[model samples]
Target: MTNTTPQAASAAESATAKPALIERNGIEIIAEAERTAKPRDLFWPWFAANVSVFGMSYGTWIFGFGVSFWQATLVALIGIPVSFALCGLIAIAGKRGSAPTMVLSRAAFGVHGQKVPGIVSWLTSIGWETFLAIMATLATATVFAKLGLPSGTGVLIAAAIAVAALIVVASVLGYHTIMKLQGVLTWITGAVTILYIILTIPHINMDAVMAIPAGSPQAVIGALVMVMTGFGLGWINIAADWSRYQKRSASDASIVAWNTFGGAVAPVLLVVFGLLLAGSDPALMDQISYDPIGALASILPIWVLIPFWLTAVLALVSGAVLGIYSSGLTLLSLGIKIPRPAAAAIDGVILTIGTIYVVFFAQSFIDPFQSFLITLGVPLASWAGVLIADVLTRRVDYDENALFDANGRYGAFDWISLGTLVVASVIGWGLVINQFADAASWNNWQGYLLEPLGLGGVDGPWAYSNIGVLVSLVFSFVVTLLLRRGKIRRQEAAPATDGDN
Candidate 1:
């Protein structure tokens, strides 16, 4: 992919300036050097992002359903690939449109109307950032305790603050810094990940672990949703934010394959390690923490604990940085009109407070994390459905300038696209049932589609198989296509009416 297409428009500027690594590309067309990433470059960035306890706990969650290690690993093996592929697929928009995913959506949702999804995407990014911060803080505190320091409220709060602040600093440095950090840390984290798997091999009891029964079909389905929702759908909103840096000539297939494989490496391997740890021991659930580092300490030697703990903390911080950076982009995409770095700083501040509360105050991780992922999946998946359909059907032949102009051809509001997003989100909400969450946690779930509506019988299957996301994807796609068909008809008719006059 030679981006030899001559720097978007400004040839002279492309030759003179090396592109500001920290500026905003949220609402503007990505000019020259900013479009420097290749398809292969995406491999490590994604690898570093997925290598964390944030995703590890999801693997550990499978044991809560009483699935065997082998069975749990099977579910993960199936789900992780499916989810990561979506990341690759969604990333194509970054290259094709020469903009962030949220900016590209302006072609779908209209300039002003996009604020709705933009806000949702913003919250999604912030939610991820905040959640990752909480995990990192707790992980660090747990590690400190293992090292014979305080893991009490004071220590937890301090760790949370420190981790959140560091992430913010990295994030405010913007795109290149995050990628560079990830590139370098990918090696450290990758080594620790390998060491983790190696240590776990010495403890594996294949006979007993394999004997753990696969649960009922309903339960299996629920576990599938848990793994897929936690890993896959959670990433949909931010796919383009990272991929937009890929040169325009980057291979679509390479982008998808690299993203799928690279992103899958750490999560799948770590989750497998987690599932095995749980399935091998009956007392596993008793030791499970929101941060899985403590749980690892219980099984591995104390000598192995510190490096694993420290690396886990670092990976979690990296994950949060990705979220912080993208949340800032989404904020700008919402038409905030602020400098990108400033937007990132503002998000960092909020994340700091959120991290403190979740780590020190809330003192609970699994419930919130599970519910958060389920809640985020619906709207994002539905939104992806719209864009996927548009790309496939050629509905995405957009005018780059018109995307930003409120009075231009795309307009300030596109009721058809906006309405599709709304309806799809509603359906996504309804069918989504938090499989891992208790009834109390269920009440707070965004995917709590059935309870408030008061439909018991219908809720059972809907919650079990959870077809809401599927329905949202297909429904939005079909609806958007129909709307485009109608819009084109009207446009053609207007020309005839003028001719008649």
Candidate 2:
């Protein structure tokens, strides 16, 4: 038998504890052989790519719908700053830890239990990618429709081909190439929109803005909840996903700062822009035109409008392809094991199906997302809350190997964290359900237990919807803290148990 010294063992443990990679250029990128090429390889490109992704095809219609310019601006101004602050705080951990969102799931879900959220992230990516693809195709067809072109199946065919080609190029070129193109398009989109807003400022409908609906507080709050879910969380919420590719290192604080600032500013701007144009009598499709392209056409000369509109379409498709490509990579990371090209092809096909359903078949743009938010979005958002709690309370930072290992520091199942998630989700959803139950029969339970608490019932704040994401999140965070605190008590009581045993 051989005996090892305690000092040697300690040294080995210390070496194992070191982080795998360092931060660079405000990105928490991994060390690799083939680096990002120059120009597009830098931070501004990455920043631009991210901004373009958030700047969408239906921005004008969605943000501007039903609200005055100032009112729409009010929502963006107030909502964005609050939401991004949370994202920014989380981004700091990602930058410092150099972990993807799924990788960070280990801390909250347990080493072995990570597969729960991992699969959720993967599935969500697939669904959202498909939805975006469909929307892009629809948007493109609408642009042609506005031009008095053929409004038949030919439009769908052309849009599909265009979107698929863009996705193929983006997937093959990978991050660096995408970012470079994103930088150029970002400037283009921004320039056109800013110019259009300035031009259209004179046409603002001040009275109509004041008349925008406040039909029910429940609906308004529900919409606000949706806004938060849309902005704050994503299928792949990892801050490091982009930052990991940066060329230089910055503090965790810096990453959070940039993410928060950008996130805060972008959505508000898009929504506010949407509101400014809300009073236009154009068709819904026209309202959400790829950008200010058609609107610009209305404002500018025929010669200039044609080129500018084309640029807007190019940028819009580029942004959509980026989403598809990113989601495909995320799917691959989830163990799809297919080559990038092959996976992108598969994603493109699925996206086509989703696009058709959303754009051509569906009556409303927000319906699918609303459904998704209540069912899938709430649970995933709950997962985020639990993760934040775990990171803060447990301090159970897994080493890289442990991140991959099923039975490392985490048990076969971290029942504590899992239990907290399940309980919080059930209770939160029950709040939504109890609202629709027969009121006269179960009125006591519904009104007394659920209504006042905003769970469910006639006057309940979150009735007829499975959207207690905020409530679930708050409950999950509280439960996690209690469990972690209980753990401390258990440790203290351990010696007493030994004596009793």
Candidate 3:
């Protein structure tokens, strides 16, 4: 007869019992038994979050760079996939480490040093979530106006509250709930988005679009940077968060493939279509500059506005949910002693406050806010470069225990990686220019090296070309690869903690 002690029986029961609807996992390594997620599972969240009609606004934004339809199309085609592929590469770390991205980053930056990037990651996530919430609220109010409802400040506030609440609830409920919700949202939003495209097809004037003049080479590069920063780099910090639940046995190539495919497919198609429409109509481009989703609604028939608005708002919420959820994990990795759900709620509250300020109080918020996020993207790309190098060099799986234990192999701080991040960011800032005329005066502090580098000063031909993001990424990556290979190999060979076995 098999004898099972009470302790064993209880443990077995706990393991076999259905997981709580609310996700309890935080920054810790996912338990092996629960790592049942497949590579294809990554498709839903990425696809749903990115399928928003707002991607079409990139068409207008790219054209604003003075690029022709063909040049803009080339930029979108190259930039979107390449950027998300970086995300895909980072996602490989998740399957290998079975922990949140920042947690796994401890391998490169050390336990204490990881906190530096962690703070940036947290702030970036919060900023992104808030931005999405603001967009959704505005989209809601605009749609209501189209529907002949009162779309005043009060309505905007109500919409903000509603959007914030929805994002918070889904994020707090956590991963499983989010995954299921994203799967459903993907179908709903995708179908509606397709309908939106079909309805707006007649608006595209191919001849006018073809007649648009081509921008300078520098302008093409600038448009490319915009597409990348707006799409992939925006989400790279949290790239691994969604994949942490993937089974350890999952193929890394598959992880990258699914992530890249899911994220790139929609944006590429949407942005190209948007380019056609915006290139054809200058007035529509102006409308999109101020209000992306609502402007798209302006082109559609009154009958389809409701569905279009609903899909756009839902898609925005889907993105905010992903951001808030990852931001919560990032919070915990920062040593915040709170449950994941509570952390998500905290970010949601912050998002709500930010939305209120932007919608109700701030004047000319979007341009500055966007420019600020893009500026921050320099450091983020630097961090990503360091982490990607570390991931590529280390052959063994992350020492899961060492990731949390400062005294272990990963150490308390990695000076090489941290130093690389700082240097790269400094150089990067000097290379990029803040093109937003309404941006804060401080933003002009960048591009200081422009004249020295002979790239023309801030007002030169390369002024719009944000080459700093790429420079930071490449510089940090190469430096880390050259310097950290030995350290990573030694760290990997170190003795595993008793629990790790």
Q: Can you give the TM-score per candidate against the true fold?
A: 0.88, 0.74, 0.96
In candidate 2, what are the lDDT values of residues 1-501, reduced to their tens digit?
A: 011122333444444432323211111123322222221233343334334322432334343233334444555666556666666655544543444556556645665576676666656766665654554465555556566677468777777667656765665555556666776776776676566556556665657555655434454455455556555464225444555433334554565566666555655665555554554434533644432334434544334444445555565466456556555545554556565556666767776666666655665544435455455565676676777666565442234334444554443456777787777666666554432233222322322336656455645545643356667778877877777665534422432211110
Which 10 successive residues of model 3 have the least lDDT summed? 1-10
lDDT of 1: 0.72
Score residue 78 of candidate 2 by CA lDDT. 60
Instruction: At residue 387, give the lDDT of candidate 1.
Output: 71
- Candidate 1 per-residue lDDT, tens place, 220-330, comes to 656766776667567777787878778877888998999898888778877887776666665654567445666665666778888887788888888888888888878
lDDT of 3 by residue, 1-501 (tens): 112222333455447556789988787767666778999999999999999999999998899889999999999999999999999999999999888899889999999999999998999999999988988988888888988999998899889999999999999999999999999999999999999989889998999999999999999998998899999989999999999889888999999999999999999999999999998898998888877888888888889988888889999999999999999999988888888899999999999999999888877666887678768989999999999888888787887778878888989999999999999999999988877855566687888888998998998998788889889999999999999999888887889844431
Number of the top lDDT candidate = 3
lDDT for position 413 in model 2: 57
- Total clashing pairs in model 3: 0
What local lDDT score does residue 283 receive in model 2, on the 0 to 100 scale?
Answer: 51
In angstroms, how far off is 306's CA in candidate 1? 2.7
- How large is the C-alpha RMSD of every model relative to the true structure? 5.0, 8.5, 3.7
270: Cα error in model 2, Å = 2.2
**RMSD value for candidate 2:** 8.5
Winner on TM-score (1 vs 3):
3
The number of the candidate with the highest TM-score is 3
